[model samples]
Target: MPVSRRTFLGGGLAAAAVAVTGTPLLAGCASDKKNSAAVNAAVKLPTYQKYGAIKPDLPGNDAVLDAFLKYPANPVKAITDKPGDGQPISFITNIPGAIPPAADNNQFWQAVNERLGSELQISMASNDEYPDKLATRIAGGDLPDIINIPPTTVQIPGLLKAKAMDLTEQLSGDGVLKYPFLANIPTVYWKGCVFNGAIYGVPVPRGMSRTTLPLYRADLLAAKGIKDPAPKNFEEFLALAQEMTAAKENKWAWTKPPLPYIRQMIGLPNQWKEEGGKFTSFYEAEGSSEALEAGRKMVEAGVVNPDTFSAKASARKQWFNGGIASFDIDSFVAWNQYYADNTAGDAFSVNMLDVPGFDGGQGKPWMGSALNNVTAFSKDSKHSVETLLKIANWMAAPFGTEEYLFRKYGLEGRHYTLNGTDPTPTKTGVVETGIGLQYISDSALALYWAGKPDVPQRQHAIQEKIADRLVYDASYGLYSETLSKDGARLTKQMTDLENEIMSGNKPVSDWAPAVKNWLSSGGEKIRGELQQAFTATSGK
Candidate 1:
């Protein structure tokens, strides 16, 4: 699991990722399923146009982000003209941290308002509280001009169709080319923004290049004089864990049993496997039994942190920071926290194993769906769709641009200080710019850090190594009523059972019957629904 400025901090990461669609909290609230099903309807999605005003050191490919080892010495404005009328514009979004200083007191917010030539009014809720707020707003028809739709929020494409702008006419195919910055978003990611048969919103993009992985403390390994050979297979990884565990010195090898990583290494399907338009859940896949057995073995090896057996991510991070644990799984986007928090100034290094296959073959690294959320234009607002879109375009200017730099670093001398080319955030900037502003309309997630050039450099190297072997969760952007209604509950059921089996509370053989239970209880229905979506969209 990962936590950071860009990534939501407190949530169930694995289950959320696997769900791909949404949660069940809003099951009691009904909307027209016909609208959600419109995702199956075919239309031209947004086309791709990589921003080239400032070239990146590590160019992006397919799912990889254009990686910048350092910020441009002098950034040019990506958009010169004002995108919107100077009228007040309101946005409702979820925040990863506390609300920033209000517009009256915040210089950063004031500067952004000046740039956009509008009073950018913002309303925020905590990530956990956002769903209820969104649902309430949608039901009451009180949406702001711009609404940030959380990826895991229950899909209400029909409701959105009623309350939000159907952007197909303005954004579909080359229509989005009119907004070059929005066009800069990779094409494949546009599927997430389309709901039913309409482009309901513009996506807030994440990336697969620097995805979630099992990262280890290379500094700790070097301190112990241990060489990192980048494990060839499961066997080698287990051996390395065994060698790294030093219980006598309050150190452990693993933060938790890497079940998902193991399942991926064994060549299991990512959430679902599709063949000839038929879909099968990963629990029923051929190698699932072996993956579970391996997970159990890894847990029983006495190398895992005991605290990690329970859901204690915050506690596990403590162990990692205190050197009580060597390996912890997290996103590369979230990895900067280590260096940012370090006082030792040793540039505490980290590295990953490249996730070798269970049998010493190529391992498939899981690719993220690349959508954080979609920011929709609310019909309730007085602003015109074109006007809102222009404002969004201004907000979404790509990295290395002056607009991007200003939004990110605020006034450099006050909000941030430069460390070489890096605009390191000061305490004021942390309280101001780092607030939930990106939830409005951010450029696709790029690879860059304030002062740590090697961090992104290493991330790019890892992405290149796994480039050919990346496996994406195909369930994303697909219509599934059963999944939308009871997905969180169902995923939690299977995850709980998997944890039980891994912790030895339930025998590994129990997996067979448990999986059978899953199929009869919505899994089959969800599979059928996904199959229909796949067929409708893919024309298989």
Candidate 2:
């Protein structure tokens, strides 16, 4: 299959041929024998040490990320010397939008090399191409020192055992104290990184506060003398969508059907719901059919954007921002990204639609996995694990430290300029810096908007209101061989059926057969295997 370049804004597909949204259901480093969450949580993890050159304005725990309102005036140093050996280090990671300028010509890269005290190299692939590239590299016996494992990739358990270094001794228990930065990473993130009872990778941590939500144009509705169109139920939501859509005026209610939110409103499981010792995939949930019926009706009524099924994520975001759609589904981070992209003349507050209940009562939002990606090391790395660990520790330096300033923003004059207390990235900085490095290893997850002090508080407030209501997948930390073989086909089949039903090519009656096909094609086995794993982990 030909690969396409793609960027990430959080959830959803990386602009693939088919939209495979939501976080992947399997771990990149997993084991068939058992999941590590339960065992590892009881084992000695790194001591939970905390550090920040500057304290957060809005305090947060592991669930909520610490907030920073300004760049430190004089950032303090965390590492006294370079972490890298005097040799070259090569790694691979996904760069969302642009392939950064080459290291030879890239001043930002050169500066990072200077700070690390070694030549650093990266094989940056677009998100869509990463799985293929990684598999090829592993098969060819030409793996980079560091490999960023994306969740969507398959055959990871065997791959990690065969090729990835085991960091159990180096990172487990109090061993992680040697790398203070790594030690600072929350235990929850590390729990997801364990495989087969051993620590194999470091997580790019994510918070559970908010993952994906149905966002709306509050300003647009206000201008039309409308109240916040947070509907009371799915039925009311459809009416509100119809009320908001004016296709002749180049507006639609939303480009994509808010199926995830719909699932939430109708009280479906996060991904799997368990009852009476049986596990059920969201596809087999009670609300699954109802959500599909509602979706078809909306499509039939022309309330959905015509381009929804085919349009790229970027295009959909543009449509939403331009008032071509009054509501759309997006990652929580888009709240800040959209703000950053908006101009003074086009300023508007992006409001989240409360995940309304089916009966017009309270609703629940799904909490995604505690990580986006995990950074793993090659078992055959030329450098010692200790040396690599040191480099990772330096790279994982806390935000507001000098190491973070350099690694994140690059050289002061070249990559960024100070705007008030904000460290504004230069055009080169924006184009060059964010391409990959910060992802190789990250500091503690923080909520910081340099120039915009209010954003942190606002985001915190939103999270506080929603955190307790979030639901999680019962099979979150477990691995599934059945899912690996059959998930893609089944997911695509169901998604295609949805699009077909919505576009009137198929009727709602088609859903039962489609689901039956999914069940026959290993969905039932996946459910059983996940239940066994869940039982093993929960001791239920």
For model 1, how does the per-residue alpha-carbon lDDT over 1-540 read when each residue is reduced to its tens digit? 111211111111211322323443333434355444343346677888877788889997765667998899888776878876989999998876567888899999998889888889988887777878877776676788998877566645544666778899998888998899889876666666666566778877775734678888888888878866577799998998898898787788988888878988898877765677777788899999999999899888878876677656667877777778888887776576666555445647777668788988788877654667778888777888888989888888888988888888899898988888888888898788855667777787777876778878887788888867776555555666567667777888888888888888999899899889888998899888777766664531
- Candidate 1, residue 500: the lDDT equals 88
What is the overall TM-score of model 2 with all chains considered together?
Answer: 0.89
* CA RMSD per model (angstroms): 4.8, 6.0
Which lDDT value does model 2 have at 34?
Answer: 44
Give the clashing pairs for model 2: 7-96
For residues 370-442, write the lDDT of model 2, one tens digit per residue: 5667788999899999888888888888878888888878877888888875787778887778658766788
Clashes within 3 Å, all models in order: 2, 1
How many clashes (backbone atoms < 3 Å, residues ≥3 apart in a chain or on different chains) does model 1 have?
2
lDDT of each candidate versus the true structure: 0.74, 0.71
Q: All candidates' TM-scores? A: 0.90, 0.89
Which pairs, if any, clash in model 1?
38-196, 39-196
